[model samples]
Target: MVRVVVVDDEPMVCGFLRTILGSAADVEVVGEAYDGAAGVEAVRRSGPDVVLMDLRMPGMDGLTAIEHINRLPDPPHIVVLTTFDADQYVLRALRAGATGFLVKSTPPEELIGLVRTAARGHTVLSPSAARRLVAASTDSLSARDRAREVVASLTEREIQVLAGLGEGLSNARIAARLHLSEATVKGYVSRTLDKLGCVNRTQAGLIAHDAGIVEP
Candidate 1:
């Protein structure tokens, strides 16, 4: 089973997530927290495989909680849940080690799929969130330059994989596009992450988009 924790200040939102996630036989809602501080405690106590975190909270906030959670010995993958697609902190949260972003209005089935994706150590970004991230990449010139340098180090095939990631395509789709096996595409993705020194595929995708390996 994929263990998950939902962290949102609103009790209704937490309960909503609990109900939706409960419908999936392979997913288990292990814990829930009403604030970032309590979210940290819940993570420590539950040791969930994934955390669905809200960006705005009463105390400590989601960004602060994400940083703290990432510092844990064995951190769970965190997917930020936000009300807006272009939330100002989305880029910063990704830099702070969030695995991905999901708009709060995402369909329940898609949310469940994303949670499973996070559990499997892959990044999950809603379509609108991906566009927002790519559009915001131009805001940091120095970061883009560094991303370009890192991307330049990738092999030709690896570059193709990174482009697929930037476009938010899954491993199977990437394989089909590049005419490679899924296992081979997965290997390339792993190597690309290592080369870019990224914590997750979402970060790598940001770099690829910023570096012009893929059109925004």
Candidate 2:
């Protein structure tokens, strides 16, 4: 089962997430919290496989919570809950160790799929979100040049795999698209992340966008 925690300031939002996630046979809402501090506690208490974290909250915000959770041993995958317009916060959250972000208005089935994707240690990025991130990034042309230079060092297959990640394709989907085994795709993903010195797949995906490997 994929255990999950929902952290939102509003009780109704938390309850709604609980209901939607609970309806899935393979998913369980293990805990809920109203703020960043409590959210961190909930994660520690439940040891869930995934966390749906709201970026804005009273007292402590989602970004701080994500950082705190990341410091925990064997941290769970954190997918920020946002309006999708908050590009800065979303990008900061990803940099602080969130696996990805989900627009609050995402379809129920798609939300479940994204949660499962994050649980499997894959990035849960949307093309639209990535585009916004790329546009909002303060990185100048020099940064883009650096990103491209770093990408050039990768093998052609690894670059393809990274582009798959830029498109938010999971390992299974990337494998099918490339006509390679899922295990091979997984290895390439690992090597690519290591080569880029990225903390997570989300960072690498963002780099792929900056590098123009997959247009944002």
Q: Candidate 1 regions off by >4 Å?
A: none
Off by over 4 Å in 2: 140-146, 149-153, 172-180
Best by TM-score: 1
TM match of model 1 to true structure: 0.88
Kindly give the number of clashing pairs for every candidate: 0, 0
Model 2, 1-216: lDDT tens digits are: 999999999999999899998899999999999999999999999999999999989999999999999889999999999986557878878767788888899898888888999998877776777778877878647658988989988999999999998888888999999999999998999999999977688888888888888875
> How many residue-pair clashes does candidate 2 contain?
0
Q: What lDDT tens digits, residue by residue, belong to model 1 across residues 98-179?
A: 9888889999878889899899988777545666665765566887788888988999999999999888889999999999
> Alpha carbon lDDT of residue 199, candidate 1?
77
TM-score of each: 0.88, 0.85
